[model samples]
Target chain A: MTSDVETRVVRIIAEQALLEPSDVKMTDTPVDLGIDSMGLVEAIFAIEEEFDISVPFNANDPQGSAFDISSVRSIVAAVKSLVADQTT
Target chain B: MRRVVITGAGTINPLGASVPATLDAMQEGRCGIGPLEIRDVDRLSVRIAGQVGGYDETAHFDRQQLSLYDRFTQFALLSAAEAVAQSGIAFNGALAERAGVVLGTSGGGLNTQDDNYRAVYEEGKNRVHPFIVPRLMNNAAASHISMTYNLQGPSFTVASACASSNHAMGQAAQMIRTGLADVMLTGGSEAMLCFGGVKAWEGLRVMSKEACRPFCATRTGMVQGEGAGVFVFEERDRALARGAEILAEVAGFAMTSDAGDIVTPSRHGAVRAIAGALRDAGLAPERVGYINAHGTGTTANDRTECAAVRDVFGGHAERLVISSTKSMHGHLIGGTGAVELLACLMALRDGIVAPTIGYREPDPDCALDIVPNVAREARIDVALSNAFAFGGLNAVLALARA
Candidate 1:
C-alpha cells in the first residue's frame, strides 16, 4: 500500500483552479479540467520540480492508450512508486 | 516602401543579460545549459535547462507600469525600454498609434499560472489571483509593450511555437514595408525555465540529454532556455534623421509552414522559407555570405534544416558560415528566433560568425558549414536567421549591412 500524496495533490490542484476538492474526481483526467496539452505539460512539470523526482518524459508512447494518468491520485501514485523503489 | 533598420537591441539570455556578456560567451563558444536552478529536479527525467536568474522587474520597474504587466511581458517591456532608450530615436507625435509593436512568445505566464494552480489545488483555495488572466494570456507581453512605450501603433503578439519571435519580427518588418508603421518594437519573451514548464516539455521526448549539438552526429536534443530578446526597428531615413545607430538593415522577411506534421519539421517548409527570403532580399543565393540556422540541436531540426539549406543554396551551403547561437544560449523557444536574429544582425554588423559550440561530430544529413565549435571572422554582407517551430511554423529574416 502506498501513502496517498494524491490527496494533497488534488487539494493543491483544486486550490489553484478555484474548484472545491469535493468536485475533483480522482480518476478524472487533466483533459476533463480543460488542461490542454500545454497546460498538462506545465502542471506535470511543476509537480516533478516540486517533488524533486525524475518522472518519465514520455509516460506513454503517442500511439498507445496511456494509463488514465489524468488525476492527482495517479500522478501521486507514480511519484510514490518511484520514492518507494529508491528507498527499497 | 520604407526601409527598416535595427537601431537598438538587447537581451537576457542564459549566458547573461547584457549584449556584451552573452557575446563574450558566444565568441568563446560556451554552453549555458546546466541543471535546473529554479525547480527541484530530483524526480524529473529531464534535469537541465537554460535559466535567467534573479531578474526581478521590481528592481528596474516603473511603479505605474507594473500593474498592466505579467512577468513575461514585464521582462519584454523592460528590455524594450532599454533598447528604445539607447536607440536615441525620438518618437514622433503620430508614431504612437501607427508605430507598431509585435512580440513573440510560445509560453506566456506559465510561471504565474503554475503558482495559481498551486494556490487552488494544494490549498483547496477558492479565489484565483486578481491578475491571473492578464498574467496568463499569451498576448500580455505585447499589450504591455504597447502601453509601456506609449505605442498606439498596430500591436500584437505572434505565437507560432518556437518560431514566434521570427514571426513577430517578420510581421513588424512587413508593417514598415506596407507603411502601416514607421517604427516597430519587435522581439520575444519567455520564462519557460520554471518548474511546471519543464515538465510539460519533457513529455515531447525531443529534448537533449547533454548539450544541444546541432549538425553533430552525436547530437541528442535541444536544451530548454528562458529569456527575452528585443530590437527596435525603424525606417532607415527616420533612424538617420533621429541620429539612431543603425546596427543592420532588416532587408527582407519571409514566412512559411511545413503543413506536414505538428512535431516533425518539413524540409519543404525550410527550403521555401530560405528561397522566399532570398527573393525578398532581392539577392541571389550565392550572394548570401552566412546563415543563422534554426539549429535546435535536436535531431529533427538540425537535419531537416540542413537539408533545406543545401536544397536552396546548393554547394554554397558548404561554404556558408552556418551556426546556432542556441549552442551557447540554449533554445529560448518563442524567444529563440528573436535573439537568433539579433545574433545574425550582430554577425552582419561585426563580420564575425558565432559558432555552434556542442557540434563535435559531423551529421551526414546535416552537411553544411556549421561554424563548428568556434567563432570565425568573415565578410558577411547578408545574413539570414531561420526559425522553425512546432506545429509547422517557419519564419526567415534577412539582414544586410546598411
Candidate 2:
C-alpha cells in the first residue's frame, strides 16, 4: 500500500512540476526535487486544475487547522484524500 | 519641501532583470512575449504574456521563506534586493524605521487564489500550505522588503489596477518630502500569468492576440506582463551628505480619478492628471522634455491619452519625445509605472529617449511626435511618467535632473 502511495506521490510531483518520475527523487525533500515556492504553487495549481477545490489563504493558521505539507508524500496523501472525497 | 531623488533602480520584467540589461533590451526593442508554458494552455483564450523567465524561487529564498511568500512577493523582494544592493547605503536603526516601504500590485497572490480554488474543488484537498496568506496578500512584497533590510518605516501596499506601482512610488516620495522618513524602497510587482488568471483577462476583451503593438495603428489591445521594478528614494540633502549618487530628482506627483466608468477612460481625467503633475512640478508645460505615456495600445486609451496630451502642451506635445515602453514590456499592471518611471529617469540621466515600439502609423487622432519604433538620443531636462488604471485611478509622476 505504501508503494502504491509512493507511485501516486511520484505522479503528483510529475504532473505538477513538469518533471518525470525519475526527476522526482522519492527519498528527497521538495527542495531536493527542485520544488521551490513557485513550483509548489504550480503543484497546487495543478492539483486545483486536476481536481477543483478552493482552499482559502490561511487554512493552517495557529488559530485554525492548517494542514502540514512537510513533504511531497504528505501533500500527495492530502490530495488523494481530497480526490477520494470528490469521487465518492 | 524636501526633494526626493531616485538613488538606485532594479527590475525583473519580461525583457530582462537588471537596469542596463532591461534598458538595452527595450532600446533594441526586444519583445518578451512568447507562448504560455506555465500550465496546459490548450483550453485558455489567451495563450501568451510577458512572464518573467528563469526565476528560481528556492535559489532566492530558504524553504521557510518560500512557503510564506507568493511568487509576486518573491519577485518584489528580489527586485528590492537588487535596488538596495546597488544603492551602497546602509540602513541603521533610526533610518530603518524612518525609511518606509511602499510597493504596489494589482493582483496580490491571484495565482495562489486560482490554484487553491483548483485544489479544493477538483483535487478535494482540504489541506493548504500554512503560508498562503503571506504569499497572496498585496503587501507581502513590502513586508518582505522591510524585513530583509531592517526597514521599519511606513511600509504598505498600493492597489489600483495597473496604476498601483505609480501610486506607491509617488506616495513614497511624498513620505520623504514630508520629513516622515529619510529613505524608502518603492515600486510594484505582479505575476498573474496563470491559466485561469489569463482567462479572467478575456472578460475585459481588450488584449492583443499576437503581441503588444503600442501606438501602432494595427494595435488591438493591451498585452499582459509580469515582474517587479523597485527604486530607493532618498532626500537629496541626505544622499549628498552621505555621498550617495543621485539618479534623478522626483520633483512632483499628482493623482486623480474619473469618477465615471470603470473600464472606459476619461479624457478629462487624463488631462487633469497630466496638467496637475506639471503644476505640482512648478514648471511650464514646455519644460518637460520627455513624456512616458500610459499608452496602453487600446483604441480608447491611446486616443484619450493623445487628446489629453494635446489639451495640456499643444504643439509642445510634438516637440516632447513621448513614447510608451509598454509596447515591449506589455502592461505590467502594477509594475508598469515603476518601470515607466525608470524610463523617465533614464531619459533624464542619459540623453536617449526610450521608444514606443511597434508604432507603424500615427492614428491621425494621436498625431504627437511619438518617438516611433526607434530609440532617440536626446538630452532630457525633465521627464514625466503616467499611470492610469481601472476604476479610473490616475497617478502622474514628474522627475528632473538633480
Candidate 3:
C-alpha cells in the first residue's frame, strides 16, 4: 500500500514537472526536477486528488510548509502519512 | 510644488492591444463589443462582452509564468511593459528603489476562482490548485508589476469597483506630487469575463444582452469588457530631464463618496467631484474642452452623469466635447478610467476627439455635446476623465496638454 502511494505520488510529481517518472529521482528536490512553485502546487493538488487526502502545503511559504516537498521521496512519505491518517 | 506628468501610456483593450492600435480604432469609431467567448456562454442571459480577442498567452508568457499569472495579472504586466518601454525610464539604483506600482482591479483573479469553483462544485473535485490564494488575491497584479519592474517604494492594489483605476492613478499622482516617490507605474486591469463572472452580473441585471449604447435613446444597459491600461507617472521635471515625450499632464484628481446609495449614483456627489477636480487643477470650467463622461448606458447612470456635468460646468457643458468611449471599448469596470484616459490624450495630442458610437436618437436627459457617431478635430487644452463606480464612489481625473 505504501509502495502504491509512492508510485502514484511520483507519477503526479513527474507529470507536473513535465518529465517521465523514470527521469525523476527519489532524492531530487522539486526544483531539481524543474518543478517550480506552481508546479509543486499542481503536484500536491494531484496527489490530494489521487488519494482523497489533504496535504498541508502553503504556496506563500513553500519551504516552511508542513508537507515535505524537498525531494520526491520526502513528498511520497508525506502523502503516505496523510493517506494513512485519512484512512485510519 | 512638484508636478506629475504621464510620460508613457500602454493598454491591451478590446479596441486593440496597444495604444497606437487603440487610438486608430478610436479614430475610426470602431466598436470592439462583440460575442461571448468564454465557457458556459449558453447559460448567461447577457452573452456579449468586449473580450481581448486573439491574445496568444503562450506567445507572451512561458509555461512557468502561465501557471503563476492569472489573466488580469498578465494584462497588467503586458501593458506595463509597453508603457515602460515607451517611457525609456530604466529603474536603476535609487530610482528603482523609489519607483512603485499601483494597479486597480475589481476582480483580480475571478477566472481562477471561477475555474476552481467549477472544479469543486460542478465537477465534484475534492482538491484545488494550491496557488489559488495568490492568484485570486486583489493585489496580485500590482505585486507582479512591482516585481517585474523592480519597484520597491510602495506597491498595492485598489478595489473600488469601476473607479479603481482612477483612484489608483490618483494615489500615485498624489505620491509623486507630494514628494513621496519619483516614478510610479499606475493603472488597472480586469479579466472577469468568465462564466461565473457573467452569471454573477446577470443577477444584477445591469448588463445588456445586445450592446452598449451610452446616451442613446434605445440604450438598455452596460456591456462588460476585459483588458488593462498601464501608465508611467513621473515627476514632470524628471521626465523633462530625461527628454521623455510627455503625453499629458496629470493636473488634478478628486474623489468623493455619496454615502447615499449602495448602487445608484448621487448627482450631488458626482457634481462635487467634477467641480473639485477643476478647483484642484486651478482651471475654470470654461478652460476644459473635453469630458469623458461616465456614460454607462444604464438609464440611471447616463441621466445622473449628464446632470452632474451640467451642474459642474453649467453652460460650458454644452460647448465642451463630451463623449463616452465606453460606447466603443465597453465598460472595463476597474480598468475603464485608465483606458478612457487614452481618449483624453487623443484629444490633447492629436486634436482628435473619439466619438460615442451606437447612438440612434438622443435622450433629453443626457443632452450634452456628445461628439456623437463621428470623431472630431478639436483644439483641446484640458480634459477630464470621470469614473463613477458602484457603491457611490466617484473619482474624476483632470488632464492638460503636455
Candidate 4:
C-alpha cells in the first residue's frame, strides 16, 4: 500500500513536469523535477483532488507549511499518512 | 513646498487604448460598455463589461515575455511604456535611483488564478505553469514596472477596492512632496472581466446586466471594466528644467474612511474628503468649475455622491459641471479613479468636459448639473476627481491648470 502511494505520487510529479516517471527519482524535490511554485501548487491541488484529502499548505510560506514537500518520497509518505488520518 | 505636475499619461481602457484615443471617445460621448467577451459568459447573470477591444496578446508580447506577464501586468507595462515615452525621461543614474513605480490593482492576476483553478478543479490537471506565483501576486504589476523601468525607490501597490488608484497616486504625490523620491510612475490597472471575475461580482448584485447609465433616472447598476491608466508625476521645477510638457498639476489629495458601512457609502465621509481636498489644495469650493464624479450608476451611490457635493459646494454645486465617465467606461474598480482623472485633465488642459453618456431622465436626488450626453467646452481652472470605495474609503484629488 505504501509502495502504491509512492508510485502514484511519483507519477503525478512526473506528469506535472512533463517528464517520464522513470526519469523522476524518489530523492528529487519538486524543484528538482523542474516544478516551479506555480507548478507545485498545481501538483498539490491535483494530489488533494486525487486522494480526496485536504492538504494544509500555503504557497507564500511553503517551507513552514504543514504539508511535507521536501522530496518526492516525503510527499508520498505525507500523503499516505494524511489519507490514513482522514480514513480513521 | 514642491509642486507635482503630470508630465506624461497613458491608458488602455474601455474608452480606448491610448490617452488621445480615450479622450476622443470621451469627447464624442461614445459608449464603451457592451456585451461580455470571455469564457463561460452564459453562466453569468450579468453579461456586460467595458472590455478593451482589438487586444492581441501575441501582438504585444513574445512567448517568453507572455509567460511571465499576466493580463493586468501587461496592461500596466503597456500603459506605462506610453507614458514614459511621452515623458522622455531617461532613467539612467540618479533618476533611476529616485524614480519608482506605485500602482493600484484590486484583483492582480484574477484571470491567471481562475484559469489555473479551473484547470486543476475542473480539468483535473496535475500541474500549473511554473510562473503562477509571480503572475498572480498583487504586487506583480508594480514589481514588473519597477524592474522594466529600473525604478529603485518606493515601489509598491495600494489596494483599497475602488479607491485604490486614488490612494496610490496620493501616496506617490506625497513621496515626491516629502523628498522621498523625485519622480514616480503611478496609476492603476485591472483585468477582472474573466469568468471567475464576473462570477465573483455576480454575488454582489450591484452589477447592471445592460449598460452603465450613471446619474440617470432609469439607471440599473454598475458594470465591471478591465484596463489601466498610468502617469509620470514629476516635480514642477525638474519638469520645467527639462522642458517637459506638463499636462496638469496634481495640487492636493485627501483620503478619509467612512467608518460606517461595508457596502453602503457615507455622505459625511465623501463630503469630508472633497472639502479636505479643496482645503489641501488651498482653493475655495467656488474655484472648482468641473468635477469627475464617482458615479457608479447605482441608486445609492449617485444620490449619495450628489448629496455630498451639495453639502460641500452649497450653492456652487449648481454651477459645477460634474460628470461620470463610468457611464461610458464602466467601473474599473481599483482602476476607475485613475482613468477618470483623465477627464479632469481634459477639462484643465483642453477646456473640454467629458459628458456622462447614457443619461436619460434626471433623478431629483441627483439634481446637480451632470453635463449630460454631450461634451462641453468650459474654462476649468480647478477640477476635482472623486473616488469613494465600497469599504467606506473615500479619496479625492484636486487638479489645476498647468
Candidate 5:
C-alpha cells in the first residue's frame, strides 16, 4: 500500500531526477535514478517543504546522516517516521 | 617583464588589529573566534564568529567620514593608511597618477543594508539615510582609498566571492608587471557579520556552531569572520631604488574557474590553479615549502583541497607544511585570501609557519603535515596561498622570500 507520504516522497525524488513519478521505483536508489549530490539536496528540500518537517541531512556528510537516503523506500520510511514524530 | 613585490602589508582582523599583532597571534596558534556580539544574537542558530571586538567607529573616523564609511570601508582605509605609511610613497604628482587601488569585497556595506532594511521592514520606518547608496556600494572602499591617497589611475574593485582578494592582488601584480602601473595598493576587506548576513548564510547550512576544525575527522563546517587586509604591490626595481623594505616577491598568480558545480568545490580546478601558479613562478614543486590553504573547515572543502594538493605536489605534498588560519580567524569570505597571504609572508620572511587550530582527530583523506594545533619554525624559501570560492572560482598566488 502506497501511503500519502510515500507517494509524495516518490514524486519529489522523481522531480529531482527529471523523471515521471511512475518511472521511479521503490527499490531504486538515488544513484539508480541518476540523482547527484545536489539533486539529493534538492529532493530533501522539496520533501521538507511538502511535509513541513526539518530533515536532519547535512550536505557535507550525506552518508553519515541518520536520514536514510539509500533507497526510495528507505526515504519514504524516514519521512513517515519524522511526520509521526511531529504529530506525537 | 617587470617584477612585482609586496613592499608593505597591513591588516585588521579578529586575530589582531595590526600586522605585528596578527603575526604574534598566529605564532601562538591562538583562537580568535568567540560568541558573536551583535544585535539580536539570541535569534541566530550559529552564534559564534570571529568578529572584530572592541571596535568603536567614532574613535577611528570623524562624524562626517563615518556617514560615508561603512565598517568594511573603515577597515580598508585604516589598513591602507598603515600600508602607505610603511611604503613611504607619497602619492603627489607622478606617483599619484601612476598608482591606483584595487580592493576585493563580497558584501560591501552589508551592515548598512541590514540596518536600513530593519528600519523599513521591521520597524516600519519610511525614510532611509541619504548616504546609504554611497556607503553601501561595492566599490566604495576602493574609491575612498583612491581619494585619500590621490590615486588617479586604474582604480577598481573585484568581486569574485571567496576568491576576490587573490583575484584583485593578481590583477594588481599584472598591472605592475606589464608596465601599466608602478605602484598599486591592493588587498581585500569584508564585514558581513550582521543579522541579515548570518541569516542568509544559515539557509545554506554550511556554518559550524561550535568550532572550525579543518582536516579533522570531527569537523562540522565553516565559521564566518569579518576584517580587512591591505598591502602595497610595487615594481621590484622601483621599490629597491627607493630603499623601501620589500616583504616578499609576488612571484606568480593564476586563477581558474571550475565550470562545474555552483557550490561544491572541484579538485581539478584547484589542482590546475596550483600547478599554473608554480609554472608561472618558475618554481619546482619541491621548492615550495609552505601552502596557506583555502581550508574553510567544511568537510567538502578540506577533503577536496587536500586531494588537489596531493595531485599537484605528489610526494612533495607530504613534506610541505600547510595550515588554515581560518581555524583561528574564521573565514572572511572575500577578504580571506588577503589575510592568509600574511601567513605566507611570515613563512618566507619570519621563518614561522602558522598552525591550523582546533584540529583534534585527523582524517586519513587529508593526510599531510597540516601544522596542527601549534606554530612551527621552518625557514621556507617560497610559499603559495590558495583561495577557492563558492562559484567554482579558484586563485593561487606564489610568494618568494625577499
Candidate 6:
C-alpha cells in the first residue's frame, strides 16, 4: 500500500527523471532512474516544497548527508520521518 | 610576434590591501575568511565570506565620485592606480593612444543592483537613483580605468564567471603579443558579497559555512570572496626601452570549453587547457615547477582538477608543487585568477610557494604535493595559474621569472 508521502516522493522523482510514476520503483536509486546530480538536487527541492521541509543535503558529499538518497524507499522514509517531526 | 611581460601588479583582496601585504599573508598561510559584517546578516544561512575588511569608500573617494563608482569599480580603480604607479609609465601622447584597459567581473555592481531592487520591491519605493544604469553597467570599471589613465585604445570587460580574470588577461596579452597594443592594464574585480548575492549562491548548496579546506578529506565546499587584482601588461621591448621593472613574463595563455555539464567540471576540459597553455608557451611539462590550482574546496572541482593535473603532467606531477590559495584568501570567483596569479609571481620571482591552508587530512583522490599548511621556498623557473568556471569554461596562464 502506497502512503501519501511515498506517492508524492515517487511522483517528484519521476518528474525529475522524466519517467512515469508507475515506472519508478521503491528499490530504484537516482542513478538507476537516470537522474543526474542536478536532477537529484531539483528532485530534492521538489520534495522539500511538497512536504514543507528543508532537506539537509549537500551536493558535495551527498553520501555523507543525513537525508538518505540512496534509493526511493530511503528518501520516502526520510521524508515521512521529517513530516512526523514537523507535526510533533 | 612581440613578447609580453607583466610590468606591475597590484591587488586589494580579503588577504590584504596591497601586493606586499597580500604576499605576506600568503607566506604565513593566514585565513582571511571570517563572519560577514553586511546588513541583514542574521537572515543568511551561510555567514562567513572573504570580505575586504576596514574599507571605507568615503575615505578614498569624494561624494561625487562615489555616485558613479560602485564597489567593484572602486576596487578596480584603486588597484589600477597602484599598478600604474609601480610601472611608472605615464600615459600621455602616443602611449596613451596605444594603451587600454581590460577587466573581468562576473557581478558588475551587484551591490548596486541589490540595493535598488530592495528599494523598489521590499520598501515599495517608486523612483531609483538616476545614475543607476551607469553605476551598474558591466563595463563601468574598464571604462573608468581607461578614462583615468587617458587610454584611448581598445577597452572592455569580460564576464566569464570564475574564469573571467584569466580570459581578460589572456586577451590583454594577445593584444600586446600581436603588436596591436604596447601596454594594457588587465585583471579582474568582483564585489558580490551583498545579500542578494549570498542568497542566490546559498541555493546552489556548494558553500561551506565553516572554513574552505581544499584537497582535504574533510573538505566541505567553496566560500565566496570579493576583491580586485590589476596588472600592467606591456610589450617586452617597450618595457625594456623605458627601463621599467618587469615583474614576470607572460609566457602564454589558453582557453577551452568543456561543452559538457553546466555545473559539473570535466577533467578532460581542464586537461586540455593546461596542455594547451604549455604548448602555447613552448614549455615542457617537466620544466613547470609550480601551479596555482583552481581548487574551490568543493568535492567535484578538487577531484576533477587533480585528475586533470595527473593526466597532463604524469610522472612530473608528483614532483611539481601545487597549491590552492583559495583556502587562505577564499575563492574570488571572477576576480580569483587575477589574485591567484600573484601566487605564481611570488613563486617565480620571490621563490615562495604559497600553501593551501586548512588542509586537515589528505584526500587520496587529490594525491599531489599540495604544499599544505606552510609556505615553501623553491627557485621555480615557470609557474601556471588555473581557472575553471561554471558552464565548463576553463582558462590557464603560464608565467616565467623576469
Using DockQ as the measure, which candidate wins? 6
Worst 10 residues of 1 chain B by lDDT: B62-71
lDDT of each: 0.79, 0.81, 0.90, 0.91, 0.93, 0.94
Expressed as tens digits, the lDDT of each residue in B1-402 for candidate 5 is 899999889899999999999999999999999999999988877899999888898998999999999999999998898888888888887888899999999999999999999999999999998999999998999999999999999999999999999999999999999989999999999999999999888667678888989999988889999999999999999999999999999999999999999999999999999999999999999999999999998888999999999999999998999999999999999889999999999999999999999999989989999999999999899999999999999999999999
How many Å off is the CA of B70 in candidate 3?
A: 0.4
* Best-performing candidate as measured by TM-score: 6
**Roughly what TM-score does model 6 have, to 2 decimal places?**
0.98
Superposed by TM-score, candidate 3 places the C-alpha of residue B58 at a distance from the truth, in angstroms, of 0.8
What tens digits encode model 2's per-residue C-alpha lDDT throughout B1-402?
A: 898888989988888878888889867867777777776588665677887888788888898887788888888887888888888878886787788799999998888877887888879999887777777888888888888889987899999998999899989999999999989999999988887778878545567767776667667777898989999999989999988888999988999999998777899998899999889889899998999999988777888888899899988987887899888888899888987777887788888788888777667878888888788889889899988888999999999987
Compose the digit string of candidate 4's lDDT tens values, residues B1-402.
899999999899988989999999999999999999999998777789999988998998899888889999999998999999999988889899999988999999999999999999999999999999899998999999999989998899999999999999998998998888999999999999999899777655567777888888778788899899999999889999999999999999999999998878999999999999999999999999999999998878899999999999999998989999999999999888889999999999999999998889989999989999999999999999999998999999999999
Of the candidates numbered 1 and 6, which has the greater lDDT value?
Answer: 6
CA lDDT, candidate 2, residue A72: 66
Model 3, B14-89: lDDT tens digits are: 9999999999999999999999898879866678989999999999999888888999999999999999999999
lDDT of 6 at B99: 96
TM-score of candidate 2 on Cα atoms, chains taken together: 0.81
Per-residue accuracy of model 4 over A1-88 as CA lDDT, tens digit each: 3487778888889999999999998899888889976588778878888888877664433655578899998898899999999989
* True C-alpha contacts between chains kept, each model in order: 0.10, 0.00, 0.00, 0.00, 0.35, 0.60
* Each prediction's DockQ against the real complex: 0.09, 0.01, 0.01, 0.01, 0.48, 0.75
Candidate 1: where are CA atoms >4 Å away?
A1-88, B62-68
Ranking by lDDT: 6, 5, 4, 3, 2, 1
Least well predicted 10-residue stretch by lDDT in candidate 6 chain B = B199-208
Model 1, residue B394: displacement in angstroms? 0.7
Q: Write down the DockQ of candidate 3.
A: 0.01
TM-score of chain B of each: 0.96, 0.98, 0.99, 0.99, 0.99, 0.99
Q: Estimate each model's TM-score.
A: 0.82, 0.81, 0.82, 0.82, 0.95, 0.98
Q: Give me the iRMSD of candidate 1, please.
A: 5.6
Candidate 3 pairs with clashing backbones: none
